[model samples]
Target: MAIVELLNQDMKQAMKARDKETLSVIRMVKASMQNEAIKLQKDALSEEEELTVLARELKQRKDSLHEFEEAGREDLVSKLNTEIEIIQAYMPEQLSDEELETIVVQTIEEVQAQSKKDMGKVMSALMPKVKGKAEGSRVNQLVQKNLS
Candidate 1:
């Protein structure tokens, strides 16, 4: 099923189960998706578009988690972690380190990225393939590791 359909179904399930946290997180995601769709002047988002929004939400949660931990805010960190888990459930499986390494190597070769100066070329070549499957920082680290 498309992401929107799946999210709708899961929302219903969360409501029925009285999963307050899950329901709230899913509702936030749905709202964000709808808001983005409106901003784009579209009736609905495509699956790829939905994934992009979801990815941004996940990244935001990750950044919050880091800040919460650094501030010694265990209560907020725990809450954020729960929300992160719920958000991630909607994302595609993350790429393994080995798989990411392989892709970075291939991208480097494809883009003829011989030095750090060609980082943009390698990143442009890799982003489409890695989108929704891996984090940008992970991809950048792998590319740097392979290129240097």
Candidate 2:
């Protein structure tokens, strides 16, 4: 099923199951997707666009989760973790560390990236291929590790 249709179905299920947290996340994601569509001058989201929105939501939750963790706010950290899980369900399967490293290596070789100076060259080529699959920060780290 398409993402929009799956989201609607899940929204109904969440309501029936009284999963408030899930319902809230779903609603927020649906709203964000709609807003993205409007920004692109469209009436609906494509599969790729839906993935982009989900990835963005996941990134935001991760950033918040880090802050909450740093402040020792275990309660908020747990809630954000749940929200991140919910958002991740709608995203493409994440690239494993090994898998991510393999791609990073390939990109480095392809771009002949010899040092940190070539970071941008490797990343520009690799990100589009890994976008929504891998984390940008992690990819950058791997690229640096491989280059130096």
Candidate 3:
């Protein structure tokens, strides 16, 4: 199902269940997606575009979670963690480290990446392949490890 459609169904379920947290997160994601579609002058987002938006939301929650942890705001930290979990439900299954490493190695070889200097080239060529399935930072670390 499209992310928006899935969100709508979940939103209804949350409302029925009185799940305020899930409802709030779903609304946020829906609004974000609608705003992105409007900004891009499209009636709707492609699956990849939807994935991008979902990924952005997940990243934002994670960043906030980290900051909250550093600030010792345990209350907000738990909330952010729940938000992260909600957002993650819509994301593609994450790649395992070993699977990601194999892909990274293949990409490095394909790009003929000789050293860390070719980092840009490797990443540019690699990201689209992994896209929503892998985090960029993890991919970067793997690339660096393979290159050096």
Q: Which candidate achieves the best TM-score against the true structure? A: 3
| lDDT, candidates in the order shown | 0.93, 0.92, 0.95
- Which runs in model 2 stand beyond 4 Å of their true positions? none
| Candidate 1 residue-wise lDDT, 5-48, digit = tens | 99899999999999999999999999999999999999989888
lDDT of 3 by residue, 1-148 (tens): 8989999999999999999999999999999999999999999999999999999999998998999999999999999989999998899999999999999999999999999999999999999999999999999999999999
TM-score of 2: 0.91
lDDT of 1 at 87: 92
Q: Estimate each model's TM-score.
A: 0.96, 0.91, 0.97
Candidate that would win on lDDT: 3
- After superposition, the stretches of candidate 1 with alpha carbons farther than 4 Å from their true spots are none
Candidate 2 per-residue lDDT, tens place, 1-148, comes to 8888999999999999999999999999999999999999999888888888988989899999999999999999999999999888877888999999999998898988889999899999999898889888999899989989
lDDT, candidate 2, at 48:
82
User: Lowest lDDT 10-mer window, candidate 3?
Assistant: 59-68
Model 2 residue 79 distance off true place after TM-score fit, in angstroms: 1.6
lDDT, model 1, position 134: 98
